[model samples]
Target: MKIFRLTFFLVLISQLALAQTKRNIDHQSLTWIRYYNILPLTEKWALHSEIDNRNFIDPICQNVFVLRVQGRYRANKNIDLGGGFAYFNANTQNPNNNPDYSVPEYRLQQDVTLINDIAKITFHNRFQVEERFIQKANATELLDDYSYAWRFRYRLQATFTLWEKEKQSLKGSISDEVMFNLGKDNTKNTFDQNRIYGALRYAFNPNIHLELGYLKSFQRRASGIDFYDRDIVRFTVYHKINRKTKA
Candidate 1:
C-alpha cells in the first residue's frame, strides 16, 4: 500500500513537470463513459464489443465517440488474439483552424495477463498491443477518405485488490499507454501521445465490474509543434457472459 501511494505521487509529479515543457498546454476536463463485454461463442471463440463516449466539460461539447467490435480467440488461459473494426469521430474545439476527423479503423490486437500473489495481496499485470489503420483525407479533385495511416499502440496496466467483502471487491490500478505512427505522412510526429490513468475498480460479481478513474492525456498537435494536455474523468462498466452448451 505504501509503495503504490508513493508511485502514484511520483507519476503525478512527472506529468506536471512534462506539462511545463510543452509548446502550448490546454487544460480541458473530459467526461468519459464506456461499456465493454465479452460473450463466449464456443469453447475457444468469443465476441468482444465496446462503446465509448467522451464529452468536453467547459462548453459541453462532444469531443470524441467510438464503437468497436472484435472477434477473439482464446489461445490459452494467459493470452488472447483479436481482430476488430472501429468507428471513431473526433471534433476539435476550433474546427476552422484544426482538422475535423472521422476514421473507420481496423485493428489487430493481442492481450496477455499475468497474476502474482504476495503477502495476501494479489496483483494483475495486463499487457496489450494494437495495430491500427486510421483513414486519411484527400484534397485533390477526388474527395476520397480511404487513404490511411498506420499506428501501433502498447499499454501496460497493473491492478491490485485493496479490500474485499463477500461478493464485492475494491481494487486500485495504474496504466500507461503509448502510441507510435508508422507512416511517412503521420511520421512527423513519430510519437503520438501518452495516456496515464489511475482508477478505483469495484467488482459487483464475477461477471460484472465498474471503474471510476482519473486520466491524464498528453497529445501532440497535428502541426507537430504544440501539445494538448487533458484531464479526464472516466467511468467504465464491464460484463462477461459464457456460452451455454446443450446437454
Candidate 2:
C-alpha cells in the first residue's frame, strides 16, 4: 500500500511539471477564414479570388490579412494552371517591434488530380515572390526599407470513399515548403522555413468538407537560430461552387 501511494504521488508531480513547462513557452492562438470562388469569363478562361483573414494572439504576430487574385486556364479535366498577385498586411501592435510590416507578393500555381475506382489523389504546387515594405514607424526615418524573397510549396492529398451513396470519405494529406532570399548581400533576415502537415478530412457534401490534422514546422535563420516544433491539432474547411447545380 505504501509503494502504491508513492507511485501515485510521482505521477501527479510529473504531470504538474509538464503543464508548467508548456506555460513557459509562448503560445499563439490563431483563427482563419477564407473564401474562394471561380468565375467563368470565357470558354477556356476563368477568374478566381481568394480572401483570407487571420488573427494571432501570440507575442510574435498580432493580426494579419491576406488577399489574392488569379486567372486560371483549364487545359483538360485533370490539370489547371494559374498566376496571381497577393497582398499581406501585418499589424505589430505588440511590444516586440518598433514598426509594422506589409508586403506585396506574386505567385504561380499548378494543380493536378487523378481519380480511380478506389480513391483519388490531388497535387498542388505554388511558387511565390514577395517584396516587404515597412510601415508605421516610431523613429524619424522618412522612408522604409524594402526586401525581396521567394518561396516554394507543394501539397499532396488523397481521399478514399467509404460510402459512395452517402458521400462519406476518408482523406490524408502532406505538405512541404521552403523559402529563400534574393538580390542582396547575405543577411540574417534571409533564411529558410519548412513545414509538413498530415490531416484526415470528411466530406459532408460535394461542395463542403472539413479536416482535422497535425502540423510540423521548422525555421532556419541565417543567424543560426533554428527552431522546430509540432502542432497538436489543426482544423480546415473547404467550399466549392458548382455552376451546373446552381443553374
Candidate 3:
C-alpha cells in the first residue's frame, strides 16, 4: 500500500511539471517578408538603398538592409502629399553558443507638407507603420503562438532653401520623429524611439537632386531590460520623375 501511494504522488508531480512547461512556451515563431515601391502620378520616382548596423553592449551584432522608391504629388501651391513602402531585413548573431537569428519586416508610410513661400518655411508631417514576422529553425513544428506585430511612427520637419540658381538649389532641413508599438502579444513593453535628422539637398535640375544627412537615434524597450542609442549618417540621391505645373 505504501509503495503504491509513493508511485501515485510522483506521477502526479510529473504531470504538473509537464503542464507548466507547456504554458511557458508561448513565444510565437513566424517568417516575414516585405516589398516597397514608390510611384508618383506625374513625376519620375527616386530610388534609394540603405544599410544599418547595431552593436550591443553584450557585443551582439545586428544589421539591416532597405530598398525604397518615392515620388511626390502636389495638392496645391502650399501643400503636397507623398507615400512609399519599404522592404527591410534584420539579422542578429547569437550571443550564446547557438545559430544566428533573423527577422524580416515590412513597412509603409505617407506624408503631407505645408509650405510658406514668403518665410521660406515648410512643415512636413508623416505617419508610418511596420509589421514583423519571426522565423523558426529546422526540426521544430511551426507554431501559431505569435503571428504579427506592428509599430506606428510620426515625424515633423522644417526646411529652408539656402541658395537657388536657374536650374539648381541648395536646401537644408531638420526633423524629429516619435514611434509607438501596437501588437497582440502583451510581452513587448512599450516600444518608443526618437530621432533627429539634418540633411543637405542639391538640385542638379528641375527633376534631379541629391541629399546627404546624419541621424541621431535613441530607443527604449518597454520591458526596461534593453536600451539602444546610436548615430548614423546617410547619403541619398533623389530625382523628380514628373514635371510640376506652374502655380
Candidate 4:
C-alpha cells in the first residue's frame, strides 16, 4: 500500500511537470462569459446562437470575442446534426510597440453529436470539422486578409445529478476536447489545442440554465510556434425559447 501510494503521487507530479515545459509557457488567468440561446422553429429544426467574451485578467487584456450561429436538425433521439458559421476577432498584442492590431477569423463548421445514458449518467460525444480563414500579414502591409486551414475537433462529456429531491436539482459535469489541424497552411504543428473542464449546473425552472466552471486550456500560438497554458473561470447562461418538444 505504501509503494502504491508513492507511485500514484509520482505519476501526478510527472504529469504536471510535463504540462509546464520550457517552450514558452504563459501561466495566464482568464475570465470567459458565454450566452447560448436556442429557439425552436419546429419539432425537428432549431436555431442556435451563441456569443463568447474572453479576457485575460492579470494585465487586463481583451483576448477574443466569438459569435456563432448554427442551424440544428434533430435526426433522432440520439443524434443531432448542425452546420454553422462563426466569426472571431482577437487582439494580437503587437510586440514591436506599434498599435495593438486585430486579427479576424472566419469559419464554416459542421458537427454531429451523439448521446447515451448509462447507470443514471448521461454521456455526450461530439465530432466537428471546420474550415478556417484567418487574416495573416503580408510582405508590405500588416494584414494579408486570407489564409486557410482545416481543423477537426472532438469532445466527450459526462453529466450526473449531484442532488435532487423535488423540482430543484443540481448537476455536475466534466468534459475534455481536443483539436487538430490538417491543412497545407499549417506547417509547424498539426496538434492545435486541448481543453479540460469541470462544472456545476443549475436549471432555473427549465427555461434557463446556469453553469459555472473551471477550465484549463493549452494551445499553440497562431502567428508563431510558441505555446500558452491558460487557467480560466467560465460562466455560461442558456436560454430556451419557442420550444415545442423536450430538449
Candidate 5:
C-alpha cells in the first residue's frame, strides 16, 4: 500500500505541472509619423483631422496606418465634446500581430475632454469610448467574417510653457493613457494596454507647431498570456485654421 500511494502522488504531481501555462513576451521598437489639423467652424464648434503612419525599425516595414476625423463642440471654458470615425490598416507586425493578412479595422469613437489651467501649465483629462470592428479570417487565413469589440480609454495629459513669445512658444508635454476591453468573449484579458508618452513642442506661430516625442507601450495579446512591450519614436505636426479669438 505504501508503494502504491507513492506512485499515485508522483503521477498527480506530474499532471499538475503540465496544467500550468507559460507566458510569451515580445519586445519591439517602432516609429510613428503623424499630422493633425484643427479647423474651427464657429464660436463653439470645430473639426479635427488626423493621419498617422507607423513602421517597424530593423527591416523598415509598415505596421499600421490610421486616418481619423472628429467633430468637437466646446460646451464651456472647461469642457468639450467630441466624436470621431477612424480607419486603420493593419500590417504584419501590428500591435495585435497577424502574419497572415493585412486586415482593415473600422472604429467609432466618442470622448469628453476637461481642461484646467494653472499658471503656465494646462491639464487635459480625456475619457473615450470605442466601438471596434476588426475583419476576421478563417482557418486558412482567408477573410471570412468581422468581429466586434468594445473598448474604453482614459488619458491624462499636461502641457507646460517653457518659454513664450507673442506668436510662438516652446512647450513640454507628458501624457499617460490606459485602455480596457469589454465584452463577453474578453474575460481573461480585459486590461488591454497602457502608454506613457512625453514630448517637446515648438510652435512656429499660432497656427503651426511641431512635436517630437517618445512613447512606451505595454499590451496584452489576444491569447491573454502573450504580451508586447514596445518603444516608439514619434514626430507630429499640429496645424490650426480659423481661430476663434473672441469666442
Candidate 6:
C-alpha cells in the first residue's frame, strides 16, 4: 500500500498548492447514483453500459445525467480494448446562481484497460481519450451552437478483499483519476480535474455487487482563474455476467 499512500500524499500536496495559488474558488457538495452493467456475448466480445445521475445537495439541485454504452474486446488475459459513445444532460451553477436549464453533450471515447493481481490485491490501470461536442452556452444559459474539445484521462485503482462469508464478501478500493484537456480552445483551464476516491464494496454473489464511495473533486473552470472544490458522495450498483470468470 506504499503506492497508495505516496500517491495520496502527493495529491494532497497538489491540492494545498492549488489553494495557495488560486484565490477564486467555489465549494459544492454533490451526490452521484450509478448503475453499471457488463454482459458477455461471446468468448471475446462483451457489452458494457452505464447510467449515472448527479445532483447538487444541501438544496438538492439537478446537475447531470449520463448514459454510456461500449463494446469491449478482450485483448488478452490482462488487457481489454473498448470504444463507446456517451450522452450527457448537464446543468451549471455559474451565471444563474442556480441551475436554470440543462444542456446536452455528446462524446466518443476509446479506452484501454490493464489488470493485475498480486497476493489477492488487484490493480487496475485505465487510459481513455474522449472527443467531446458540447452545446454552447452564454452567461445566461445554453445557446444553439456547439463546440468541440478533446481530452485524455487516466485512472489507477486498487482493490483488496476485506472479509469473506458464504456467497458474500466485502472489498475495499481506492482510486485516483486525472484529466487533461487538449486543443486550441483551452486557454484558461487546460488542466481539467483530479478525482481521488475510496469505496467499500459488498458482493452478494459473483454477478451482483454494491458500492458506497466518496471523492474529492478539484476541477478547474474555463475562466482559468477560478476553481471548484467539490465533495462527492457516490453509490453504485454492479450487475455482471460473472465479469471476471465468464470468459
Q: Pick the candidate with the highest TM-score.
A: 6
lDDT of each: 0.70, 0.51, 0.54, 0.80, 0.84, 0.86
Cand. 4 TM to true fold: 0.84
Provide the lDDT at 152 for model 3: 66
Models ranked on lDDT = 6, 5, 4, 1, 3, 2
Candidate 2 per-residue lDDT over residues 71-129, each given as its tens digit: 87767655566666667665532325535344333343343323223335454444444
Task: Give each model a TM-score.
Answer: 0.75, 0.60, 0.62, 0.84, 0.85, 0.87
Give the total clashing residue pairs for model 4. 0
Q: What is the lDDT of candidate 6?
A: 0.86
For model 2, the run of ten residues with the poorest summed lDDT:
110-119
Root-mean-square deviation per candidate: 5.4, 11.8, 16.1, 6.1, 11.2, 3.4
| TM-score of model 2 vs. true structure | 0.60
Superposed by TM-score, candidate 3 places the C-alpha of residue 34 at a distance from the truth, in angstroms, of 17
Clash-forming residue pairs, model 4:
none
Model 5 agreement with the true structure over 1-247: per-residue lDDT tens digits: 2433443454455335434757677899999999999998888888999999999886678899999999999999999999999999888664444466677999999999988898877988888999999888653574767888899887878999999999989999998877878876667667777788999999999899999999999887778888788999999999998555546
lDDT of 4 by residue, 1-247 (tens): 2432443454456446546655666677888999999988888889999999988887777788899999999898899999999999876432222244667899999999997898999888888999999888643345755889999887878999998766667899998877778777776546677789999999875768899999999876654347778899999998888446654
lDDT of 3 by residue, 1-247 (tens): 2433443454456445434542221111121122322224443233333333333224444345555554556767667666666555545422332234455555665666555444677766565555544433333343434345676666667889999989889999998776766765424434456677898988898666777777777555545344446555555555444634333
Off by over 4 Å in 3: 1-40, 43-62, 69-73, 78-84, 93-101, 108-118, 130-147, 186-188, 242-247
User: Who is ahead in TM-score, 1 or 5?
Assistant: 5
Query: What is candidate 1's lDDT per residue for 1-247, written digit by digit as tens?
Result: 4544544565566556656664665667888999999888888788889999988887777777888888877676656567777776655543233344543555555555455566664554444556665555543222344445566555556778899999899999888766656665664566677788999989998789999999999886566666778899999999887458431
Tens-place lDDT per residue, model 6, 1-247, is 5544655576577567666774588888999999999998878998999999998886787788899999999888889899999999987654226646678999999999888898998998888999999888876788888888999887889999999999899999998998878866776677788998999999999889999999999898878778888999999999997634345
Best by lDDT: 6
What is the C-alpha RMSD, rounded to one decimal, of candidate 6?
A: 3.4
Better of 2 and 6 by lDDT: 6
